[model samples]
Target chain A: MMKRIGTYLLQSKYAISVTVLIFVVLGASLATSSFLTGDNLITVLRQTSVLFILSSGLTAVVLTGGIDLSINNSAALVGCIVAQLLLLGVSIPVVILAGILVGVVIGIFNGLLVGILKLPPFVATYGTNMVVLGISTIVMQGKVIYDLPRNFTPIGVGYVGILPIPVIIAIVLTGVLYFVLQKTTLGRNIYMLGSNAYAAKYSASRSVLDTVVAYVICGVTAAIGGIVLTARLNAADANMGNSYGLQIVAAVVMGGTSLLGGEGGIFGTVIGALVLTIIMNVINVIGVSSYLQSMAVGIVIILMVWLDIFTRSKREKLSRV
Target chain B: MTTKSLGKRIGSLPPAVWMIAVMLVFYGANTKNYFTASNFISILIQAAPLFVVACGQTIIVLMQGTDLSLGASLNMMTVVWVVLMQKSLPLSVALPLAMGTSVLAGYLNGLIVAKMKLPPFIATLGMQNILNSVALVASNGSSVYHEHAIYKIIAKSSFLGVPYILWITIGCFFLTMVLLKFTRFGARVISMGGNPESLKVAGYSPDLATIQAFTYTGFMTAVAGFLLACRVESGNPIVGNGFEFNSVAAVLLGGTSMREGRGGVGGTVFGVLLIQILKNGLVMMNVSSIYQTAIIGIVVLFAIMLDAYIKRRQEE
Candidate 1:
């Protein structure tokens, strides 16, 4: 029974991340007086909520054997547009829809480049990211748009039964995505397509536009995350999304989602997001200079990836034996 | 091949050349001082650092690998050079110390990609961030100003009516060309990208080529980074921000096959020229930096799409 359990753990992509998250929480709670506090934990959860939402869409893209380096910028652009509309006295509902519509358009543009046109995901998205950043700069005149509407506050910070709205939104989004990926035809198609593109093309169960659909979903999710982030900050700026570029990619990667695609899922991403937040928090509690945070994050990603690699090779050896 | 087919092939070269041609004409006609020799010199000098890095990046891409960390490593070298000088170190001591770190980074990147059995994309990216952090930590996360008269003199010196930096860039270009065109290691590098299996059949490990390519990139990035630091006379943490992307874009525009490794570093010179010229022209035309980058991004994207479409048609 122990051997079977061990084998299962070795085979599961998410097992390591979950184990890491739990151990971190246990260690931090024991060592740091501030770590176990309700306020700190809630703050961690809020950060995870925003990160997880962004990473979920990225997970979908990576699953299709592609990446969207522009997702952060797209989210930023959406936030900028939403902020402008809010300032213009537009209703909250319309503002939200408008943000999503902008996301959808960006998604379609990216979809054409990567899917139909067959450009490289990173190159296409990187270029698109630059364009998105430029447009946002022009949209906001490179200034922060503060003073968000009061009604939007509940979405970012207000609580329902002592749980933050962003957290609730994240949980609901994760559950829906988990169901869709596990139970839907589109989800299976994505998996097959990612695993072997040519084989998928010949398979009778294939849809020609599976790649496009994956990107579109990614776009929509990015918009949702952007709206929440804007509400959370109560402002928008051109460079706000710039920092998330590395973090989001790192989170999605840590979540056990392979960059090469066809393996891993939403659940792994949740753990990935939580673990990232805790690591950043630990850096703060330990009083690493705030300026060195970027370096610290870089080290965390390298170590995490190396650990993953080390474990993977060990798993292969055990299977071989 | 006959002259007719040679002319035909030239005519059918990728869309980037045509686009650059149109851009040159339009900007030349519209912008004041766009066609002057002084502007040309300024653009070439501006392209110098990027051109040098792109030459090294050419080999990396030719081997079907990417070094997302080059820019960061370059950034690290700049700050390290300055910090060492600030500590009263002489030129000989400061130069090697700074250059060695990035070379080491390149070596680590090679090991991660070739030996650790990890993908180059993530490994290099992780390394890039680490190097970026190191630069920040070394210089306290801001610009470091130092009075390095040697670099300033080197920057100001003109040999044969051209600045020393331009000479260095030109030297690196020819060096890269000769290395790619004449060396056995170069053959192995190209083969590693074109077909790793064939390399093994020829009794050369593709892994060694990968390592060698990365090390080369490290050395060139150090040279370029330090030169740029001298030109600007300060160690800015983010000075090397866009070189990685710009170098890759230059490589692509040069018509090097990213997948097949079918081109040479010789073409990358023109690609670098195109980019620097475009930026200069836009600056002269009063375009803001942000929008200028956007336009360049769009043009690059369009060229890539057109190239892909043409390649697909050829394959079909």
Candidate 2:
């Protein structure tokens, strides 16, 4: 019974979160005297907000055993488009809407190729990412765009009392996404599809295209993330989100979302994002070179994946024997 | 009977024929200069490195694995080769050392996946990060802009009016093709991918096959890097930032299945030809490079879908 309990604990993604939280506490407490201060914690939250937002969508796609590599490039493309529009004197709301719409189009293209046409998600997204990045580069001509209107900046960098706007956005978005993923018929269908596509197809309760739409929704969330990032920086660059692709994936995996699909929760992803943010902040506090961060992050990712795999195999073995 | 045999001939041409036809048509229509002897030669020379790498990548993808570290490995190998040669090491020594580093890197990736049981995607992704840093550290973020005479001439000189690199690329392709078709190792690779469990039961480890595929891909990627070093007469840190995608796109376009156990070197050759021609044709036609890249994505999607459909039909 003790062994079984231990197995259950190991298999639970919550176990990893507890571990990360413990590390976060230790790192925050030790790295800087003010790391536990409300302001510093909020700053970490703010920094993690965009990744949290983006990974929310990616979590869904990954649940269906698919991935969207286009998000980072999509973010770049949307950032470029919005920057161009903002430069041309577009309203904040219009730019935001257009940014999301652009994501939808790219997502649909990815969906049609992967869902309807049966292309591998990796290849389809890879091609789309390159295409999008290329377009973004052309749009920006390798230039950065600043001069955002006042109202738009608040969405990313502003505060309501003690909380950053992006943190609030992250919370609200997480709640809404959690509801959609855990409660709705559509959400249930997505889980079904990811668990077993052929089974879902035969159940008379799910559609592959609808699941594909879910993947598109993931794309849209990533777009929102780009808009927020642009607002935070008060400028949009052509390669703004170039490094976020792997980072977001790492965040999702650490959150215990299976890349094979059909498992995990948004809440876990939020915590995962927090862990990543704290790690980055702590690294900064420790005065490590920026280049070394990637290597460190890579090692952490491998370790997390191993733990995930180990816990999963342990559970599978238990269930069988 | 002849009609059925004729139909079989058409069927046997592979779905990649459409991609080949599209490239040829575009190459012809885009410019009066496109199909001329001199330009064709130039295009082939331009495509040599990509083709070599694509051939390697195709083999791995055929095994249902990917090497994200290919680009970083290429960059590292080029830097290592140049920096080593500057220390007065002979070409023979520098070349082997570089190739050895790449193999070790690839072997490390294979070990991580096969021995450690990490997902190929994640493992290769990790390797890419590590190698990127290693490359930076090796050269202290410096560019090697000068090299020996032979290195420069390898990219510039031609035998029989073809760049020496082109000949080397062709040789690699021929060697790869022969190995894939005629070797025990190749047969084992296909069998392992076809059904890993059955292969395991038959006393062959899928891990071994996977390692072999990765090692080949690594070595060939280094070869591609060496050619690029020759072409530029210098090794820039940023030279191989996105070649992985180009190789992958070429392989996917050539008629390789993303799933394991199918595809061949011939398909990859055609795929590389198609990609190179498309890029060249777009340049000739004055299309924006962005739109050109977008078109390649669209074309690759169309080709993959067609391949999948035909494959499904065949299975039925």
Candidate 3:
């Protein structure tokens, strides 16, 4: 029975993430009554919505065996552009479209560098990150754009019946992405390409286009995250997305997406995002010093990746036996 | 025929050398103060610590790994040094302790990458966070100023009309050159980058090479941190911010292949100089800091793209 259970655990995609989430939730609940409360849970979900969107996009890139460090900066730049446009009395829809377009352009640029030019993804995205940061700074001049339009706030804070709009948006995007990843031939191509690009080449999978599309999707999602973030804060700043880059990476990796690529799903990412949010919430509830939060995050990331490597190797050994 | 061959030789020189020559000609024509020896010395001084740090990054990159946490590690070392000095510890004691902390930080990063088989980028990213937090905790989020007579003397004093910092930087370059060219360890590092599996097949542990490379990186970053602290006379939490990217840019700009062992310290020196010169030239040209960063970004992109094109052509 125990062996059967072990096999079941290994077979299910969501099993490990679900198990981890349950433990985290239970731990949080036991630590403080505030954690289990409906209000706090909603708050956690609301806060996680932006990260969820960002990580969803990052997962696609990781699955393609590439990374988009520029996502956070792209989001920040988009937010800044949207905020500036709104301040200039542009229509909200136009501003949103412009932000997303900017993201797509940046994404295309990254795709060209990584896909066609064959530049290393890390360095290429890092260069794009710097360029975006510079543009964001030039646009805002290091100042915060606050007092956004009242209509824009709905996207961030408005409720849809019992659920927050951001949470709803996150859910819808996750569902769409999950479908695209699971049901489409393109999705299969992406996995195959990431798993072994050399083999994928001979298979004629249009791997280059697949890589480009992955980054484009990543960029669009990050832009959406930026818009939500700007609305939520009622302000935009060039530095707003600086921390999100590493955070998204953490979430995507913790979700069981291999950095080596081609082995994770959106369901795992959602649980990973939740785990991170809950850890943050627990830290807040316990009144841990804010200075230690980054340290905690770093430790969690290392532990998660280490656990991943350990488990995969163990499985390999067991299979060999 | 001789002239054609000479032209070809010049053409074969690393892009950084050409960049330097062009910038020199352009800036020499455009800015009146650009050609002055004093201005040149100032540029060297500014580039000194960055050169040291980039040397460390180059070594790690040569091993097909990266150390994104170097900037944070540098900051932590600086903070520790200053905090210890603030507690009335002598320079001799505080300096070694701070340096030791850097070695430990590097060792931890090496351990994660070598033992756990985590990608260097992710491992170093996590290490960066941890080190940044440690720096914050050590400094309590404030800059610490120290103006000891000995500290100032070491940083500011000159020998043979060159700044002490410049001398230290030169010493570091010589040391790195020797380590890379004269040591078996260095050969192993390059070989590991060229092919990790082959090293294992050859009965050498790539893991040891990885650890040693990171340890060297950690040591140099600590030295750079010390030099920076001495120069600024303060240990600010944000002092080392953005350095990781800058150092990586310099290393790559120097012609080091991001993939593995295709470049070395010779190109890296020129890369560091090119960045410093660019910054100095921008300042002289009155370009806004924001535009300066953007231009640097563009330059890095252009350099890598050009390198890629050249390499592809060669392969063809």
Candidate 4:
């Protein structure tokens, strides 16, 4: 019975993530001793909250076989906007509303390019990333604004009865996204579009035009991630989210979403995010050099993709035999 | 019948016409000095290295593959060349050595993608990381400075009121154009890109074609690195960052299909100019460098979308 349960667990994609997470927790708990304490655990959750939110949005876009490389830049720009407006004494709610709106606008722009114009996703986002970076730089004049109000800070750091507000928000967002991805008509359309757009159009009455909305959601989520990041840092810098674009894509893909699209889920992505966070924390704990860390991340990425490919082809060979 | 053929030819111009027209308008509006001999020459000189790099990138993209490692490869060449020159080797020797390393890098990228059957994106991205690390290590993470006379002549010194780099860029363009248009190898490349499986069935090897494309990209990256080294009169390990994007942007903007099979060095020429001019114009107009990045990004998006629209209309 134990062996059968083990086989079932090991056969799942979530297994790899679970194993990695366990290794991290065990390592952290052993080394720091303070690591498994409630406060430290809460700190890890809070740190991971922003990445989770961003990855959720990116998950939707990748589902449609598209990527949003401009998210980091978009986040930077939105964060700068949020900071500038708050400095102008704009209310917290209004700042939040404006931030979400800016993300949607960027999303709409991405949608127009990919959906209507049919430009390749990689190229379209590459261009928008530069634009967003430039805009953010202009807004902040290459400075970080640090004078945010107390209410703003709580969205990232505040807790209610041992659970952080950001974590709570992340949980709610995940549930909502899970529903949208699994149960909604729009969600199914996205899967159809990513898997086979032509077939979807002919069979499911899916419009390529409307499928663009998914990318917008991806953009907005990235913006929200930016807001959370700004709150955590208590400032908005021009290049703040720069490292995220590649990392989030790595996390999503590692979580089992195909770069070719139409596979994977948020549950896997959450684990992926947690695993990534743990790997990063482990790297820090182990005191790996920053330069070497890039090489390590690159290696891990290649290995994950290689394993997926090998397993896929092995299965294909087995079926053929 | 002749008019119909002419109409078709006009329709096929795609994004190049708009890029050129926009460049001219932007230049004219932004500066009274736009058409002056000095300014024209300056723009060409500034665009020289990018144009040479994009020439290589154009060939690879024509084969329906991309070389994201171009910038990283260029950085490697720059560092190597700088170090070799520093070791008292003549500029001539160091330059050839740098070019050779680029070819090797390109060859490896081609091998991984063609032989190992790795996706071009993953292969090139891996090559980018490896080369980026090698470049940092080669220079020990510092810029290498030298003052060789020949190097100065090649990178910075001008002849007849034009930079030597401009001449090199033009020379490379003409060579690529001739090779692509007149050589059997070039014909084979276009055919392979058009349909690799069909080409294979017809007794051509797609692997060989892919390798050739990558090798060409490597060689051009070296040429670009040489120009950059001379222009700055030094080689900084990190100097080549964003070069791949610039090259890709130019190639795509110039009407080269990302899917390969349909691109030319000629269109890439105009595309390179358009990118360089847009950047220079932004600087000239006193737009902050930060905002300029955003503006360029937006313009590139517009350029690609415009290209897509033109292609769609042509199909209809």
Index of the highest-DockQ prediction: 3
Q: Is candidate 1 or candidate 3 better by lDDT?
A: 3
Candidate rank order under lDDT:
3, 1, 2, 4
TM-score of candidate 4 against the unseen true structure: 0.88
Tell me the tens digit of each residue's lDDT in model 3 across B1-316: 6999998887667678888898899888888778888898888888888899999999998888788898899889989999999998998999999999988989888889999998898899899989988999999998987768756775778989877887888888888878987998888888887887888898988888888889889999988998888888888787887778888878877888766687888888888998889889989988888787778778767877787777667667
- Candidate 3 runs further than 4 Å off: A1-7, A197-205, B1-8
Best by lDDT: 3
Task: List where candidate 2 sits over 4 angstroms from the true fold.
Answer: A1-5, A31-34, A37-39, A197-205, B1-4, B85-92, B139-143, B313-316
- CAPRI-style class, candidate 4: acceptable
Pick by TM-score: which candidate is best?
3
Tell me what TM-score chain B of candidate 1 gets against the true chain B: 0.95
- By lDDT, the better pick of 2 and 3 is 3
lDDT of each: 0.83, 0.79, 0.86, 0.78
Q: Please rank every candidate by TM-score, starting with the best.
A: 3, 1, 2, 4
Residue B202: error of model 3 in Å? 3.5
Q: Which of the CAPRI classes, incorrect, acceptable, medium or high, describes model 3?
A: medium
TM-score against truth, every candidate = 0.95, 0.93, 0.96, 0.88
